[model samples]
Target: MLVLAVDTATPAVTAGVVRLEGDTPKTLASRITVNARAHAEVLTPHILECLTEAGVVPADLDAVVVGCGPGPFTGLRVGMATAAAFGDALGIPVHGVCSLDAIAVEAALGRDLLVVTDARRREVYWARYSGGVRVQGPEVNKPADLEPTPSQAIAGSAGHVDLFDLPVEPVETPSPAGLVAVAAAALGSGAEPAPLVPLYLRRPDAVAIADRKK
Candidate 1:
């Protein structure tokens, strides 16, 4: 099956085309631009480029996969919204996977691993994984609030990885290949696609103000 995958949960705006044969996902092409503020501007173009590089068209995709983020509100929306739009337009299922899981899926560490991504405001989005499966949080909190096991290794954005004293495995962002690979089982089992929800973890910084007392 031909699948298009995207992830914008970190500074990277990522897109790719993957061929899933049975349980394996092979990345045909991918493009990533690392800029926190360019998600809206760069995502669609990246998607198109990935498709072109993979020698496929939107109509040829059998499914779409996206990273549902525990990330900043603005950046996270771009990926999920774009994936949903493509899925709707092509009449294919859109699968949502945790942005953290994307990174976790690619981790080569042999021990427990912790995945962290910038959440801004001096905080991070984190999860604990063992054997490539998430065993704990996709939660957001200050780095100091997290307790990493003595043997745990870290994978994620550089700055956040520095927050921990552990050995950093250095994974800056989720890859499109990882995003689709992690979702392959669900897709194969015909499980319902994940809801199109942004895992902002916290409310947006901007909020409505009530009218002044009149």
Candidate 2:
């Protein structure tokens, strides 16, 4: 199965072309560019370039996989909207994989691991994965603000984290490869595409501004 995967949950905007056969998922072509403020501009071109490089067209894709982010509302929706538009146009199933799960899978950490990402406003988007199972969070806030709990390690940016106390496994950033891997698992489980909804853990900055203005 040929799959088109996209992610813009963090500063990085990533797109990948993967072939999923029996068990293993192989990457044909992938690209990632970090642009904390360019998600809207860069995401589409990256996706197109990836598909072109892979020598596959959108219509040829058996499925589309998107990172359903617990990221900031504005930055996270670019890819989601693109996924929806493509899925609708191509009439193919588009699946959603948790952005944090992708980061956790990339780390390939132990029985307990925390995946975190910058959420702006001095907050972090965090989730816990244990023994390959997501156990806690997708919590958006300062790391020190999270309830004191111990995990095997932590991955992703730790700016808001209490480094001396939290376990340190640091995955750094999310990648298209990890996102594709999670998408493959979802496909294997017979998960089909649905409306690409933005997994915003909190209201958008725009909404906050509008409320304040009123």
Candidate 3:
């Protein structure tokens, strides 16, 4: 199976093509740009480049996987919308995985881990994983509010990972390989993926005019 995966749940705008056979996923090509504001500009080109480098066209994709973020509204929208559009155009299924799960899947297995990503406003998006499966949160909170044990290794954004004082594994951000790996079961089942809902975790920074009058 050929899969196209994308993630903009962090500053990095990531895209890749992966070929899955049996139980393994092999990355064919990928591109990542670390610009918080360039998700819109960089994502499409990255996708095209990834597909071209992988020697396949969009229509060749068997499925699309996307990071449904606990990230900023604007950046998160870019990835999800692109994935949905691609799936629609190609008439393939689109799957959404928690952005944090993508990071967790890349961690060393059989150990407890804490995955954290920048959520702006002095807060972070975090989850606790045991043996690569999320056992706890995909919640957003102030870093200091979520205490990590000495045994739990850390992964995700460098800035937020540093805040916990735990052993850091330097995951940085979600990758196309990670996104597709974590979504493999769904892809294999041949079921229609659920709706691609953004895991904002908190309300958007902007509010409606009706709420401002209070």
TM-score of 3: 0.96
TM-score of each: 0.95, 0.89, 0.96
CA lDDT scores, all candidates in order = 0.89, 0.79, 0.91
Residue 51, candidate 3: Cα error in Å is: 0.9
Model 3 lDDT tens row, 176-201: 88898888988988988999899998
Q: Report model 2's TM-score to 2 decimal places.
A: 0.89
The alpha-carbon deviation from the true structure for residue 146 of candidate 1, after best TM-score superposition, in angstroms, is 1.2
RMSD of each: 1.9, 2.3, 1.2
lDDT of 1 at 43: 93
lDDT of 2 by residue, 34-131 (tens): 88799989888888899999998888898888898888877788888888888889988888888988888888866577777888887788887789
- lDDT score at residue 186, model 3, on the 0-100 scale: 85
TM-score, ranked from best to worst: 3, 1, 2
**Residue 21 accuracy (lDDT) in model 3:** 80
lDDT tens digits, residue span 1-214, model 1: 9999999999999999999988888999999999999999999999899899999989999999999998898899989999999999999999998999989888867789999999999999999988777899899988898988843799999877887888888677888778888899987887888678889999898665753332
